[model samples]
Target: MSKTGPDFYDDEAVFATYQRHRQRVDTANDTLEKPVILELVDPVANKRILDLGCGRAMIGKEFLQQGAASYTGVEGSKRMVEAAIQTLTGTSGHVIQQTIEAWVYPPEAFDLVLSRLALHYVADLVPVFTHIFQTLAAGGQFVFSVEHPVITSCDRGWSAETRRQDWVVDDYFSTGVRVTYWMGDIVQKYHRTVEDYFYLLQTIGFQLEHLREARPQRHHFQDLQTYERRKRIPLFLILAARKAI
Candidate 1:
């Protein structure tokens, strides 16, 4: 069985580390992904939003606060959905626990579909992309993030005790599932080159609007050490695409 289910994401430490501290701490996301996503999507009031892999309503809460019409979040982890519910009580959106790969979407339902740092776990994106295209209204937007190919393309090839964050990238063209360590869990994520992502989107007939290899701007990082290290390589990728009107 593929480990990319609710079980992979339900751990208390993982949720606390990634979802909860995402915006609070000046992690890679706060310095890079958030700024680009906000700039690219530019959400207006009363737009119906579908949040795929909506982890704990962190980004969903922002949409609701900014006056979204509705925010329906699809999350695989039951615990994440529960946490989202707690945060979204008396709010405009509700979360459902379902894997993005198999989750049934309401036809032509949303004005925007937003996913952050989630699709990497999906080993195959073809079916899910098709579904996302079908779920959006004509001219609707899809904004999403993934672990950058540079980061995903190789195994660290170092021992657990190795402190060096250096990455090796010998197998760039070979695409398949990659196992990575995070929060003491053996997490499985898919790896695809930048060209592969663009090609797949084009093949699915999604109009590419913006592409960003997430990099921190000047003074975006509080710690100089973190900033310098991140500047050497891309951490995340944001793609904004649209369906034809």
Candidate 2:
């Protein structure tokens, strides 16, 4: 749940539910999303990083610890901003409490820009991505992750029965706003196809570098069943693009 201003995460109950979800081992964020995102942003040393929708800034803390020159996070939720500040304590990192849509991007200021599971919450991507391209120095990388179209295409609430079976990827070609339940709250998310993402980046003048479906890996999990079940469908779509040098 990244910043769509006035989002469910701002609610205490939803925030508490999300914290508990993150604490559980083998969740998608830990086993699937984080590793892929880190792999795409390797060799963080000496790079200026800008994180959009940074929740708790946990990864920003890691980047700073790995010798990133500086870290800046933009978040809309006050609670998330406070948590991000604490997570980045003792490091040369800064956080700005603002929505990605509203943040004033500084031109050519960062070597890398990242967002995780956040863009889907944004209704308009062109303006946001244009800002990302403008803020990054030439050859800078932009890496991000979002809920896969298969998951976003349908809004059926999740349940134990559905968890054990294959997902129904209905209306996959249709793209628009979706209302779904997550973290014990109803949230609005935008649905876009894989081609839509690539097209937008290329149209925004970002050279495509890498695209991943957040594949399952053996080391990411301890249970064979969990690993096998994860292979059934792609949970996330990750992309890495670069501003031409």
Candidate 3:
């Protein structure tokens, strides 16, 4: 048995489990599902882009399709990097295998850097944010999206009955929290409250620009029941911040 969200990309069985759920929901087509970070990015033609933890290259693909000058994706999982490469075959892009903690890049090399639903997996934000700040060019923007701590705190269970409620946060500051995997096993996830995120960006010299809580739109709700519930509770949060010169 493995830990930490079943290593979804590396483990075939775990990937299958996620794929099944994703298929049921048709995640790729959900426009309201436009990633919070991506909305802020606004990739322009002929600009260099870096996608950390690129995961299957979905966001990177969008950048290429929108006419980014060039794209580079850095992913930790070899399998995922391969999948990204396959997805972008014959396209103008490069995918490399590396962990965010250890990856290195030329300073001020990219115009835009993006990571979606990936940074929270990191145990510490200091080094990662530092890396992003150093790697981005002057006036470059770093955009990212993460599961809203409050929403994830409730473990994907916030129905209309539970809306606007207070739940005991066992350890809001605990660095270690258990994340249940697809195989029903648990693993430690890094924990940081909303303040931690805000402070880290300020400390690293990033100017906060956009912040939005993404609630599944009414059209996404399967029925009346889900619509009422999600309206009061959002599932993800997207943020856009710029590195100051």
After superposition on all C-alphas, the RMSD of every candidate to the true structure, in Å, is 2.0, 2.2, 4.0
Structural similarity to truth (TM-score) of each candidate: 0.92, 0.95, 0.83
Q: Sort the predicted structures by TM-score, highest score first.
A: 2, 1, 3
Candidate order by lDDT, highest to lowest? 2, 1, 3
Q: List per-prediction Cα lDDT, in the order shown.
A: 0.84, 0.89, 0.70
- By TM-score, the better pick of 1 and 3 is 1
TM-score (C-alpha, index-matched) for candidate 3: 0.83
Model 3 poorest ten-residue lDDT run = 154-163
Q: Model 2: how far is 107 from its true place, Å?
A: 0.5
Q: 1-245, model 1: which lDDT tens digit per residue? A: 33674677787766666565565656777788888888888564888999998877877778889988989999999888998999898887799888898899889999999998899888789999999999999999999999899888886675544544777876888898887776556678899998888978889989998899977786788878777777888889889999999
lDDT of 2 by residue, 93-128 (tens): 999999999999999999999999888889999999
How many angstroms is residue 67 displaced in model 3 relative to the true structure, after the best TM-score fit? 0.7
Summarize candidate 3's per-residue lDDT along 71-184 as a digit string, tens digits. 899887767777889988878888888877778877999999888777777777799899899999998988887766764453443233333454334455654454634333
